[model samples]
Target: MAIESYRLNVAEVIEETADAKSIVFDVPADLQAIFAYTPGQFLTVAVPSDQTGLAARCYSLSSSPHSGRHQITVKRTVDGYASNWICDNLKPGDRLRVLPPGGIFTPKDLNVDLLLFGGGSGITPVISIARTALEKGSGKVVLFYANRDETSVIFARELTELAGEHPSRFTVVHWLESVQGLPSLEGLSLFASYFGGYTSFVCGPAPFMKAVTTALKELGVPRELRHQEKFVSLGGNPFGDVEEVLAAQATLAEADDADEPDETEQPAAPAFAGPVAIEVELDGSHYSFDDWTGDKVLLEFLESKGVDAPFSCREGNCSSCACIVLEGEVSMKHNDVLDAEDLADGIRLTCQALPLSDKIRISYNG
Candidate 1:
């Protein structure tokens, strides 16, 4: 829903690899409940700017809830200026703006067969999931992690130690692309014997996910058994709400014919022109916006009107901006977070959804 940010101090910074590090937060006692999260959730960190302006990025929590500490592992992106900034500068005692844990990429049932597929830094949440599973000791935790080589793998040592500690319950497989080829359908299929009954959680770059899932489906892995998370921001919003919305002159476009979705990063929001009647209900308070449109997301529009609505990435990558449509219909530019069942339940993303009608009402307190 309307997620709020918290200022937490870095308590520890441990290097997980040559380019990746895990930052543990000193969460206040009063706010510990706010930060309590499921095994595969993530935290959105907002870094203040000196010359670059403010930058916000989401990092998955690598620590299990049983650890009673908040830790997120970040792998420095070679071309990502913000990532590079975090890797080079963020340290213990540094105060940073971080949103509470948020994400739906968690194990549905721990008692069932649990397998995780991660590539590169995507190992963060799966690591958490794996540890939590091992701690529970009721299910088997299997992880197939891929990286360039042993040198670049984050949490390489810790994961191995975990496997050793829980030899019977946990199994960790490493795919060093340097020795073997990059993760492919064939590479993934080799693990097929482990598939049919296991509930698979996959996260990585778009191609890796697509290739793996496609192969799984072809191998007869049921659709309901597989879950995926596209960790990057797919630009210009995602088609979140109504697939078919009123276009110019009120013409309807074919929902099934929408353009192929591109997977990460993005363009800026467009400004809305019309005088729109916007009513938002949050925390038992009501607010209104006079000018809003499909040009900009409801989150941006509300911010411009001084509503201080919740949001992280303006793209539909996370559930920070999720809201329930109360009175009118809206559509998102892109939607990877909410599925058909969620939409059917009236849940939608306010950061990506824009009002197609003149009057719209939404609530974030859900």
Candidate 2:
């Protein structure tokens, strides 16, 4: 079935933290079936920029599937155009355009041990995954969450209560910057006891996630056992905000598949030189974008053409915008999601890709 977007009415707005807020949406009875989702999926919401609040951005759903109302949390960004706007201006009774829940960051099976890691607001999805795992009797779930200070931590009380409720199944350790700063290399040794037998899921700002990724690496955790989730549009940092280390982690799959970049042949990141024609396939429908030159990325261009497609994190950090290129060449300015195997199979990030050749063929249903 084709994934669809709907305008769900805001039911309530709850302040989760000093800078963070969760907006509950009133999903109609008719839309509930489509809105139903797994543990770690996210919603891409379009809150209008002006009075109507019609602009869009992706936010991770903080409320669990067990919760009645569907809600996504937002941390007010300093100069965040979309996040700050939504925090200050959006409220209950207002309508926002929303894409149904979708994302790849979820618990795969029950037999594996689980170790979850989150930094700052990145805890949103982590909590969802952890909560669901506990309910299902998934093997021991442990979390190492990082934050700048006590107050900055999202879901702090809920996490503690959850831990108290399921002491045998779950454990949460907080790393506060004011006390000890980010988790350190020395700290990785302390968690080494659980290192060999767990699947590590890490999410947060680039630097924080990289440190977690590195700690996992030093602990001898295998690559396949690690899942990395990065927030591009962070509160202090805006979308597409990434550091060299974090960017490398996002592309690590690509790098590992190839293993080594030819020292002499390192390639510059690619981009579409100019406007080009594109063909798109969504659901079972086909559309040609002759009107859209190469002015914008593929997803934005298609949306402008009135095509209902699935996309989130316009920053290219998530697989929400991933598509398979059927023909011709396409270039991506930045990518932290798809790996080399994906590229080998023709997968590309439509949010970062621009049509390179005069014409390009792509499939969004992929």
Candidate 3:
């Protein structure tokens, strides 16, 4: 079962800044539905690599879903393989292998007021959210974008034009580190106080994200209202056949599971021994299965049942397969995205989840 991927033609390339470029894809009408994405979701691209055959990378889409365009902004990193490859090589009419849109860094409700913070290249997804919310949603949008300097701002003209077109509902505050120094905790807290009621989304360098999340927490903002996106390089090639990738991953997972626990660490609970049952809710539909044998992970089991479960980077490194546990319990073999707060809210990565109880109920509605 190979994951579906498409070869899309590059329709255009726009130089956003000295080190950034936006690649627009020309998705065919037949694949339109498969590529359709919510604002802030990302596309996984397979960049050519001599050493590894191809290097898979996830890039956030900057174009709004309503815009009928698939675009991803890439900024050159000092020694980045994929980013540099994309910026240096891609051109109009070039074809690239790309996975369908996937990711959970999106606003659930466009009608809610949005407080957005984007630092440098992090603006990629934030702009998508702002554009979609402004055009298709009835809510005010406030953007706090930070950059190294004015010249490094990626979408200066477009952002200015958007602000001008939606003057009453859209506002943007530009922060240049060269001019104002790096944004401090106190300053970020003061700014966020003005929109305490709005749903906040932060994507940036690590320090910037930490400051914003800390500020939101200090303001007593609920966990549900605070969202942040963390960028990590994929360790495996997701463009490979899915079964091959899963087989390799299972070998590593088994090796890890065989290791003895450290004396200081608490022992994990035993897994459910017999066949299990599960009830799931997704896209307003209900499904139940009574034959889960506890041998396969949740996502794999669901796929075996012909359930169209949402997933990307099935290695548990992304949140596209996150689901909330409604009843019973499950354990994750590996997780890199969800935090303590997310786990407290019953959010589990379905790709890594294994049965811990006889019966479980989960929902992808959230």
Which candidate number maximizes TM-score?
3
Candidate 3 residues 1-366, lDDT tens each?
A: 347899999999999999999999999999999999999999999998765677888999999999999999999988989999999999999999999999989999999999999999999999999999999999999999999999999999989999999999999999999999999999999999999799999999999999999999999999989888887778677777643635776677769978766443333356576488999999999999988876788999999999999998887677999999999999887787888889999999998888898899999998
What order do you get sorting by lDDT, best first?
Answer: 3, 1, 2
**What TM-score, to 2 decimals, does candidate 2 have?**
0.69
Off by over 4 Å in 2: 1-4, 50-54, 234-317, 321-336, 339-366
lDDT value for model 2:
0.73
Model 1, poorest ten-residue lDDT window?
235-244
Model 1 Cα lDDT, one tens digit per residue, 1-366: 234577899999998888988999999999999888988888887755553235567888999999998999888877876677888999889998887787767886777778788999888888888888888748777888988898998888888899999888888889898999888788688786665788888888777877777777778877657777667632221222211232321232335435746344233334334566888898689987767866777787787777866555666777767888887677776676776756876888887776766777888765
Q: lDDT of each prediction vs. the true structure?
A: 0.76, 0.73, 0.90
Give the per-residue lDDT digits (tens) of candidate 2, residues 95-214. 877777877676677457788888888888888888877776568889888889988988888889989988888899888999996677668547745657788888888777767777
Tell me each candidate's TM-score: 0.72, 0.69, 0.92
Best model per lDDT: 3
Candidate 2, RMSD to the unseen true structure: 10.6
Q: Which stretches of candidate 3 lie over 4 Å from their true place?
A: 242-270
RMSD (Å) of each candidate, 1 decimal: 9.6, 10.6, 3.6
- Evaluate model 1: give its lDDT: 0.76
Error of 1 at 340 (Å): 10
